[model samples]
Target chain A: MCHRSRKTSRIRPAAGAETSKTIAKERLKLMIEAEKQKLDDDTLNQIRHEIGSVITKYVDIEPENIEVRVTLKDYKKRA
Target chain B: MGKVITFTSGKGGVGKTTTTANVGAGLSLLDKKVVLVDTDIGLRNLDVIMGLENRILYNLVDVLTGKCRLKQALIRDRRYQNLWIIPSSCSKDTTPVLKEEQMKRLLGDLRKEFDYVLIDSPAGIDYGFSLATSDADLVAVVTTPQVAAIHDADCVLQILKKKKKDIRLIVNNFHRQMVKDGDMLDIPDICELLDAELLGVILEDENIIICQNHGEPVMGKHTVSEECYRNIAGRIAGQEIPIPDYIRRKSIFSRIFFKNTAGKLV
Candidate 1:
C-alpha cells in the first residue's frame, strides 16, 4: 500500500506555479494507479458499517444512526 | 433484431437441452416470440424434451440443405403459440450437416423474424459446438455443481472468452436438501470458481423430469424450477430480475434430531 504522505511527498510541485501543469499530469498518473473494483452488495454494506463506525468515533456523529452510500467512479477515455 | 443465445456445456448431461427448452418456453410465456433450434444434430433432444418430436416434418438440415424454408422447418410448440423448435434429425449422420457459414445464414434469417432464437448446443467444444455458437449473441454456459461439471464449464468459459463471445453461466440441478446438507455447491460458489457472470440457477426438481417424460415444457409449471427458468428468460430479455432464493426446507436429518429446541425441565 502506498501511504498518502509518501505519495504526496513524491508528487508535490517543484515550489512554483511554473510546474503546475507537471504536477497536474503527475497527479493524473497517480489517480490511474489505484485499483478499480466491482463490489457486491453484502461486501459494500459491511464496508459502510465498518468505515462509518470508525469515522463516527473520530467525528461528531453517532455510529448506530449513521448512513453511508457509495458510488462508482465514472470516467471516459480521451481520444 | 432477435437475440441469438446458445445454451451450452462442455460436459454432457448437464441439462443444456432442458434449459433451452424451458427458457424458450418461459420467454414465450412472457409473450416474447422464440424459436429454439436443437444444434445437437445426431443426438437431438430438444424436440423430444418439448414433446414436439412427431410434429417435425422438416428439420434444420432440410432448411440448410435448401430443401425447405426456415418457417416450414420449425415445429410450433403445442403449449405456447409464441414458441417453436427447429429440431435436428437422427435419421442420418450429422457430422457434415452444419458448416459454420450455413449456421450463420440460418441464424441471420431467423433473427429477422423472432424475438429470440435460442440454440441447444451439442456437448463438448468440438465442431458441433463451434458451429452452433458461431452466430450467438450470447452463450449461456449450463453446468451442474459437481466438480467435473464445473471444471468443464471453466474450460468452456475460457474458450468463449478467447473467441470474445458474450457468455453467462447457468448453474443447473441445484438441490435445496443437498445444498443444506453441504453436499452440493451453491450458485455463488460455482460462479466464483468459474469466474463467469451467472445468468440463473435451476433447482433439482422432480417436476422437470416429470414434464420431460410427459413431453411438456416445464417452465410456468408452478414449481421453483419453473420460476428459475422464467427469471433466466427475463434477465436475457434485459429485465433485471434478481435470482430467486432457494425455497428453504428443513433437512430430514435436522427434523429428526433437532425437532425440539426447548430443553426438558427434568
Candidate 2:
C-alpha cells in the first residue's frame, strides 16, 4: 500500500487575486501568439520607419516617435 | 521499414536528450529494435546520458562523411541488447558538419535497419534543427511548463506544421505540488496552449538526474518517472495505455469525505 502525506491539498486559491498559474497561462498565451506572428524587431522597426516616412510626407511625425505594436486579437479564445 | 522519430525542443535543457534515452530504452524493453542518434553535433549529450560515452569511437559525423561504417559508429547498449546509439561529434567548432541531404540519407539507411530510429535534436530552430527533422516521420517537441519553453515550442510547432510533419508534444519537469498549489501550469492547459497532441508528461523527479549522472536511463524501475516513460513508450508502440492523471485536483467534497482513506480518491 502506498502511504500518502497528511498535508492539506488546496485546489482553489484564496479569493480576489489571480493565481500564479493563471498569470503564467495568460503570459504564455500572449508570448506564443507573438512568437507565432514571427515579427522580429527588425521587421517592426522597418514597419515603423516605413510608416513614419509615409506619415511625414503627409503630416509632421518623426520616425523615432512612431511605435508599432503587435497584439493578437481574441487570443483568449484560441485553443 | 523503421519509423524515424526526432525528439526536439526549441529551448535548451528541456529533457530532450533524457527523453530520447529513456524512451529509446523503454521501446527496446518492449522488444523493438531501437537506435538513438545524437544530432546535436558539437554539443552532444545522448552519448553521456546513455552511458555509452567511453565506447563511442566513430560518431554521426564519421558515418555521414564516410570516415566509418554505420555499424562501426553504432554503440550497442550494455543493458538493452536491442538498443543502440550513434553519438554526435564533440568538436570545439560549432560549424554544422552534416548537411540536410546527408542526414536524410543517413536516416533512410537507419530506417531500413532498425524498427525505431530516434534522433535527439539540438536546441534552437537553426540548421541543426532542420537537419534533425529533415527525414523524421514523426517529430516530438519536448518542452517544460515555463512561458519561454512553451513559447519556443509553439515556434517549433509552427515550423513543423508548415513542413507538414506529424508532431507531438511532451511536457517535462512537471511539478504536481506546484501545480496543485496554483503555482505552475497544469498539463491540460499546456496541451491546449501548444495546440498539439499530448504525448506524455514526465513528473519532476530527481531520480532522472541521479540515473543520468550514473550514465543510465530511468526506465524498467518501479519509479513514477519509469511508469511515465513506459506509458509514453507504449503509446509510441501503438499501445492504448491511458495517460495517468498526475494533476487530479481533488474537489472539496472528496477531500472532506475521503480524507482518512488512502490518498487514491483524487
Candidate 3:
C-alpha cells in the first residue's frame, strides 16, 4: 500500500586517479539497494543470499562492505 | 458394457504393466468389473508387478492349451474385489500369443465377464505386441518422450494405423522441467509427431516407483498419479471431463510461465 523510491549514483576513477575507492564502493552499494527495491521481498532475499554467497566465495571485497535496506509497506487484506 | 483397453509401449520399461494395474484399479474403484490380462509371454512380469505371481498356478497358456478352464486361470486381485488378472506363462517352452483369432476369443470371453479389460502388452513391435493389442477396443500407446522412445513409438503408431486400430497417446514419465529446457520432448510435440490424439499425460512422479516397488497399484486414494490414470480411464469410458490444467497445460499463464522460466534457474 506504499510507494518506494531509490537512487544510486557512483563515481569511480581510473587507476592512479585522485578519486578514492571508498567513493566507488559507496556508489555500488547505493545501486544494489535500488535494484533490490524493484524486486519483491522474497525475490530480494533470495538474490541477496545468492549474490552474497557468490561474492563471498569469489570476490576480493570484505563482507562488511555490503549494505542493504528493506522497507515494508501498508497491509490490506483482499475480500 | 465397458471397453477393452490395451496398454502398449514400443519401447520397454515405460510402465505399461504398471499403468494397466493402476488404471484397472482406478476403474475398479469406480465399481467397474475390471480384468487385467498379461500378454508378455516368455518374459512375464505383470503378475509379479501386480503381486499375483504366486497365486498363478494356471495361466493364459493353460487355457489356450485347453489344460484348464479360463475361469480357473483368472486370479482375483488381492486389493480390489472387482479386479481380476490372468497372468502369462514365463516358461520358455510355451507357444507365443501369435494368433489374432485366439486373442479375439479370449477378449470376447473377458468382455462378457468384465466391465473393463486392460491388457498389458509385451515390449517392442513384435508378434507379442501385435497379438496383445489386436483385440483392443481402445489402444493407449505409451511413450517416454525421448528420441529413441518416440521413434519406436512412431513405428508402433504406424503399424496400428495400418491395422486400423483405435489408438490414442499417453505420454508417460513426462518431466516438465526437462521438456521446458528443450532437453526432452513435450506432449504436443509427441502427438503431432505421431498424428494421434492425447489420452493422458503422467508427470514424472516418484510415487509410481515406490508404488511399483511395494507391489501396490498407484490408484490409491491420495496418490496424484492414480488420479491421472483414473482421468485417463474416465476419458476412455467416454466421459467428457476436460483434461485438468496440469495435465493438458491449457492455461495461457502456465504455458507462458513455463516457456519463460524454463532452464533459467540452473
Candidate 4:
C-alpha cells in the first residue's frame, strides 16, 4: 500500500481560476512578511530609517510619515 | 577535516531524518567515509531507519557525558562499509542532553575521522536545533511543497541567515504531476520563495517510506528516489550533476505535445 502508483492521472485546473500553488505561495509570502514584522523595536526603527533614507533620495518624504506595516489585509487587497 | 552538514526543518514530519540517512548512505556509495549523527535527542529514529538499532551499545549522550569513547558510540552501517551512525539517546526527557559547545567539540572530532558528518536535527527552532546546527559547516533545510512546510522553512532560513550559516534547501515529497496540474508548488517557485540554493528535490515516491520501513536507504536502488538521493549526495560531494529537468514545470507547448517518459519530457 505504500507503493506510490505512477498511474495516477493528472487533473487539469479549470481555466481562469487561481491554482492551489499560487494561493499557497501568496499565503506563504504573507506569512513570511508578517513574521518579519515581529522584529525588535531597534531593528524596525533601523528598517524605517533605511526606507526613509532610500525614499528621500528619490523624492521629498518626511521620516515621521513613513510607516512600514506588514498587514495581510493590505497585501490581499493589492493582490 | 570532514564537512559537517546538519539537516533541519522548522516543522516536523518533513523527511529530515530520511534525507540525512539516505544522503549519508549515498555519500558512502560514492566512496566517501560518512557518519550520520542523530541530534534529535530523546526521539531518535535514524538508528531504526538504518537497521542499526540493535547494534547501538552507546548513544550520543554517553559520548557527550564521557561515559564512552567516541568510536565506541558509532554504529557502523550494515550496507555501506564507510558509513556509520551516532544515534541520539531515546530517553523520555525532551530536554537537550547535548550542549552546543559539546556538540562543536564532538563534530570537531568527527571531522578529523570522516569525510562527511551529517547531523539529523530535531523538529522546531529550539535548543536541540541550535545544538545540531551550532558547528555545522553547511545546513540543509528540508521542506515539503506544502505551504505550512514552506513557511516554517522560511522561518528557519531567516534564523540561519542571522547566524551567517551557509544554507541550502531540499524539497521533499515533491509531486511533479501535482505541480504540473497547478496543485503543488514548482521547483523554481520553492527556490525563489525560500531564497536558498537548491540542494535537490525528492519526488513523492512511496518507495521512500517502503525503504525506510525496511531499514534501508533508497540511494542505491534503481528508483527515481534513489537517483534523487544520489544527485543530492553528488552535489554535497561537490559534483556538478544537474538536477533533473522533469522536476521543473513544463511549458504549455510541451505539455500539449509531450508526456513524461521515465522522468524525462518527451
Candidate 5:
C-alpha cells in the first residue's frame, strides 16, 4: 500500500542555463549566414538583383535604397 | 473569429501552393469550414493546383475592389463540401495592386464566416509576401531539402521572428531514402537552422504531383501523403496529434521483418 505524501512537491526552474532571446537570435543569424555563404557568390548576387528589381517595381524604391541585407528580411521591419 | 494561416515560401517551386491546398482539404475532412485564398497575385498557381481554374468566376482582386462580393468570388471545392478557394487574378501585372488594410478588412469579414482562412502566399520576401502575411494568425514557411530553399527559408524566419509573429515550419518533399543515405538535409537540421517550431513534414510522394496535375489535392489520395496532411490539419485545429514522420515503403518483406523508424527500412 502506498501513502499519499506528495504535498511537498513545488514548482522549480527548468534545468540548464536558459538562453536569452537575443543570444539565440544572434546564434541563429550566424548559422543561417554560414549556410547562405555555402552558395556561389554569383548565384547569391543574381538572387539579390532579382529581389531588388521586384522591390523597385512594386515598392517604388530606388535600387540603392533596396538593401538586400541577409541579416533580416525587410518585411518584418515594415510589419 | 476564425484563424488565418498563411502558407509562404522563400523560393518558387517550393510547394507552397500544394501545401495550402492539401491543408485546406484536410481541414475540411474534419468538418471545419476552410477558405483557401490565392494571394500570389500575378503568379497564381493555387487554382491550377486545386483544378478549379475553369470554375473561377471572380478573384481576390475583384473582391477587394468591390467588383464582386467575397462569397461570389469563392469557388466551392468539387469534392470537399466545406472547402472553398478564392482564386487569384490571371493578370501578371497585378503588382502593388493589393493593400494591407483592404486585405485586413476582407480577412476580417471572412473570419466571421469561416473556421479557417488559409492564404497561399507568393514566393520571395518582397511586397507581395508582406501584404499576404501581414495579418496572418499563423505563418508556415514551406521548404524543401535543397540548400537554396533552406537558406531562403532562414531569411524568411528571421523576418518573421523580428516581427514577433508566430512562425511554423513545414518540410516538404522530404525523401527518406536520401535522408537515410545522408544525401539530403534532415528535419532536425532544418529546425535547428531556422530555429522555428515545425508543424509537419510531407515526405516525397509522387502522388502529390500526380494529384496536382489532375487538379486534385494529395489529401484525398489515401496514401502516406494523405496521412501527413491529415495529421498537419489536426495539429492546425489545435488537436494533440503526433506527426507520423516515419513512413515505410510498401513491401511485404519489409513490413513483416523491419520495424519502421523515422522513414527508414532498417
Candidate 6:
C-alpha cells in the first residue's frame, strides 16, 4: 500500500526562453551569412577590376607572383 | 472528408486573421465553398477584414449555446458567392465555446456543408487555441521573422507536436529588403530553426493592411499580396505549384557560383 503525500513542483525557466534564444542565434547566423555574401560579392568585383587593370598596365610582362602580389595588396588597400 | 485548417500563432498581431481572410477569399475564387470561423472571441476582426461586419445578426456564442443555428450565425461574404464566416462574439468573459466536445460536434456538422473550414485561432496555447486546433485536419502555423514572433511560433509548434498534430508553416510579414540587408530573418533561417515544412512565405506589403482596413480581399491581378495568397490557397488545394525561386533558391545560386570558383582555383 502507498501513502498519499502532497509534493510541490519546482518551476523551471519558461519554455519560451529557450526557443527565443535559438531564434536569436539563427537570426544572428542569417545576418552574418548575408553580410559575408555582400562582402564576397564586393571582393569579387574588386578582384576583377584589379586583374583587368594589371593586364592593361603590364601587357608586355608575363603573369608572375611578384606583380600579382603587388596588385592584390594595392587592391586590398583601395578596398 | 472536408479539410479543416486552423491558423494559429502563439504571439498576437502577426496577421493570422488577415491570412485566414485572404486565403478564404482565394479558395472561394477557386470555386470551393470556404467557411472562415473567427475563434478570437472578445476580439473578432475576421468579419471586418472580410468586409461582412455589418451583416452579422447572430454570432459564434449564439450557435455554440444553441440560441441560434449555425446557418443563422454564418455571415456570407458579399464579394464571394461560396465564402462564408461565423464571427466571434465580443465578450469580456474568456469563456467562448470552451468545450472540446462542442467544437468537435460543431466542426463535424460544418464538414458536411463546406469544402474547407478555416479557423482563425486565438493567440497563445490556451483554451481557445486547443479548441480551434482539436477540430483541424491541418494547422497552419503563422509566423513573422521578428525574434519574438518566431520564438512564440516555435513554442506553438512544440505544443502542436506534443499533441500529435500535422502542421505546416506560413511565414508572413517578411520584408525582403531587410532580409537582403541582414536586418531581418529570411526564409532559410526561419525554416532551419522551426524544422517544419513551409507552406508559404508572404512578403511584407502595406497593401495588406490597406486591404484589411478597406474590407477587401487581396485578390485578382492588381496586387503581389494577392498572388501570394492565391499561391498559398492553390498549395492547400493540393496544387503542385513551384515554390518561387526567389524565395527557395535565393542563396543557392550564389553558393553554386562560389563552389564552382573554389573548385577551379583548388
TM-score, chain A, candidate 4: 0.36
Write down the TM-score of every candidate.
0.70, 0.72, 0.70, 0.72, 0.71, 0.72
Native contacts, share recovered per candidate: 0.00, 0.00, 0.00, 0.00, 0.00, 0.00
**Candidate 5: Cα lDDT at A77:** 23
Off by over 4 Å in 4: A1-79, B247-266
Collision pairs in model 6: none
What is the per-residue lDDT of model 3 for residues B167-244, given as tens digits with 9 covering 90 to 100?
Answer: 888878888788767788766567668887677777777666544444567665355576678887776655654445
Model 1 lDDT per residue over B164-195, tens place: 99888888998888887888886657766887
Per-residue lDDT for B108-187 in model 4, tens only? 99999999999999999999899989888899999999999999999999999999998888899988788878999877
- CAPRI docking class of candidate 1: incorrect
Tens digit of lDDT per residue, candidate 1, span A1-79?
Answer: 1111231122222344334344335543543442123353456788898999899778997787788887656634422
- Using lDDT as the yardstick, the better of models 1 and 6 is 1
Comparing 1 and 2 on TM-score, the stronger one: 2
Restricting to chain A, the TM-score for each candidate equals: 0.39, 0.37, 0.29, 0.36, 0.39, 0.38
**Cα lDDT for residue B218, candidate 3:** 64
Tell me the TM-score of model 6.
Answer: 0.72
Candidate 6 local lDDT, B1-266, one digit each (tens): 66899999999999999999989899999999999999887777787777676677888877888889999998887778799999987655564546788788889999999999999999989888998899788999999999999999999999999989888888898777787778997676787799787778676776565455446666752566667888889888877664453433446664453233211100
Better of 2 and 3 by DockQ: 2
For model 3, name the residue pairs that clash.
Answer: none
Of candidate 6 chain A, the 10-residue stretch with the lowest lDDT total is A1-10
List runs of model 3 lying over 4 Å from the truth: A1-79, B94-98, B247-266
